[model samples]
Target: MENRPKVGIGVIIIKGNKILLGKRKNTHGEGSWCYPGGHLEFGESWEECSRREVWEEVGIQIKNLRFGTITNDIFENEHKHYITISMISDYESGEVKLMEPDKFDKWEWFEWDKLPSPLFLPTINQLKEGFNPF
Candidate 1:
């Protein structure tokens, strides 16, 4: 098939001293915890993608977005690679809704250091690079 890195956008919505995350299912990083995000559509700006993904994944709104970090995630087993761009934002409003029940089932907030185990590749890579979404 194709052999190029896809641009993925990840949003770290901040609420109090916690960040939002979900347990992925039926995807490359299945069973791993990850932030709300997805592929960046063509013609979409980084900020646009961040906000869209967050709302699409979980019925919530975010604001005060700031550039966070990026990670070159290569899922060797899945034969997929993504240039994951992370964005940090403050939780503006709304409740967490499992909008995509097939993709994710559980969504919650957690302290960065107390994050759930078995995080997705992009998340692990970001952490390794000393990403501090504070």
Candidate 2:
């Protein structure tokens, strides 16, 4: 496989004082908690990818998009690399429901300091850098 860092987008949808997150399933970060996001598709802008991923993952529309944080996540055990760009947005509408049952087991909002354990690598790195969208 060609060694190239894939571009990923993570959207931190804000609702009140909580952020949206999901427990990953059947993927590289299986069992870890993560934001709604995925690989950036070809010819898509950062905001476009952010919007698409959030909707595709959890059936929500987001507004007030702003740049949040970036992390170079290297999953050594999985032998995968990703440059993750996190975007912060206000939850515009729609109920938070799992759109991809195969990829995520649960979706919920959590306070920043009360996040679930075994967070995805990009999330872990972002938090370590003290990146907070709140």
Candidate 3:
């Protein structure tokens, strides 16, 4: 097996005072909540990846996406990861549905003040600290 830092992109899809979250499925953190996102494809732009991830994970099309945050982490001594960028979008179209039904158990919109406990760590950090991607 090869070792390399995995890179990903995510988005905080905003609507009014709420954000969209997906319930994770089939992983160690099964049932934990997280924003919509995933790994970038080879040669894909960040914006394109973000849009693709949102659609792939949530079955929605988003617009007015803007940069929000970047996160870096190292895990279990050897596994490293970088969330190169996270975008926030004000507009989304289509009914909410799980594109990868096995990967995500469900989806919901939640008020920021009333988010579920034990969110995906990187997302929780970004929400708490208000990251600026300048």
Candidate 4:
């Protein structure tokens, strides 16, 4: 079998000292709290995909999108993986709504230092590496 990298994107929507997080509603990592993002669809630019995903999943428009981090995840059991490119963005417009109700149960803003535990592993790691709690 040939190996191919799965490309995905994540948006870190920061407002003051808190960050936006979504409780996943879909099967893969369902019930896990994560950043707003999803797979990069074919032929879509990273910026476009990032903005689209943030809007679709969280119902908000994003501005000042900038490169953040890239995570390469390799699962041992399922042979599933992802190469996630993350970005930092400011909230531009729109009210919070569950656009994909089945994919996410809820949305909340949390202080970085006080984020709930057991967050999606990659997101947790990214937080540690890229964000300063204080």
Candidate 5:
């Protein structure tokens, strides 16, 4: 899907002292850690996409959604480019689960200063963009 830059939503769900992340599987960023998120659907708002992706991927809900930052991530190897809409949100409810096991290996929470290795490209770009949840 390289016709043009597609829009994606990457939500950083914040807890008391940690945030939710998932290990990518069977996709572009396979084996890399990333925030709970997915592509922006047609006729949907960014806020809606943030909550939807989190629930769809991790079986959890998020609130207080606010703009975090944006990244123009170009996956050269996959020949795909995306304008990632980063959303910062507070953990709302529900237990985290591998709702889409095929897309993610497992879900985990990590301190802002202590994250897992091999972050997804869009995630790495978010950090490079100076966007912080803490």
Candidate 6:
């Protein structure tokens, strides 16, 4: 068993009245809806990780980046722990494209109150804490 928790970054890309999320296809949170994000790379700041992950996963650039919230998620079934920093950003440029088909099915915009079920742990926590990026 790992003794340390992993660090991750989640990006909340707000457009109009909707937020961007993706249906996870593979890995730990498979079959859940989540925001565009990934593991925080070594030597990378949380903001940098947010930008890179968002661009890598969904092929979009984000601006007006700001700290949203943080969640300590423990996936008991998957035996993984993560300290996720949620970052808020507005959609700036680039079209919404699935840059990682193997990792996610597709990306879509959804209203906060009507988000899809089985949300990722981090996202679930964020919502439960009333972390609204709008």
Once model 5 is optimally superposed onto the true structure by TM-score, how far is the C-alpha of residue 66 displaced, in angstroms?
Answer: 0.6
Q: In candidate 2, which residue ranges exceed 4 Å CA deviation?
A: none
Best by lDDT: 1
lDDT of 1 by residue, 15-61 (tens): 99999999999998999999999999999999999999999999898
Find the number of clashing residue pairs for candidate 6. 0
Model 3 bad stretches (over 4 Å):
77-80, 127-134
Tens digits of lDDT, candidate 4, 1-134: 86887887888888778888888765566667888898999999989998899888877887888888887766545577888887888878888788888888888999877887568756866776785423
TM-score of each: 0.97, 0.97, 0.85, 0.87, 0.95, 0.96
lDDT of 5 by residue, 50-86 (tens): 8888878888878899998889999999988999988
Q: Compared with the true structure, what per-residue lDDT tens digits does model 2 show for residues 33-118?
A: 99999989999999999988888889988999999989999999999999999999999999988899999999999999899898
3 or 5, greater by TM-score: 5
**Clash-forming residue pairs, model 2:** none
Computed on alpha carbons, the lDDT of every model, listed in order, comes to 0.93, 0.92, 0.77, 0.80, 0.89, 0.91
TM-score head-to-head 3 vs 4, winner? 4
Looking at model 1, residue 1 earns an lDDT score of 72
| Model 3, residue pairs in steric clash | none
Runs with alpha carbons beyond 4 Å of true place in candidate 5: none
Report the number of backbone clashes for model 3: 0
User: Cα RMSDs of all predictions?
Assistant: 0.7, 0.8, 2.8, 2.1, 1.2, 1.1
Scored by lDDT, model 2 comes in at 0.92
Candidate 2: Cα lDDT at 110 = 95
lDDT of candidate model 6 versus the reference: 0.91
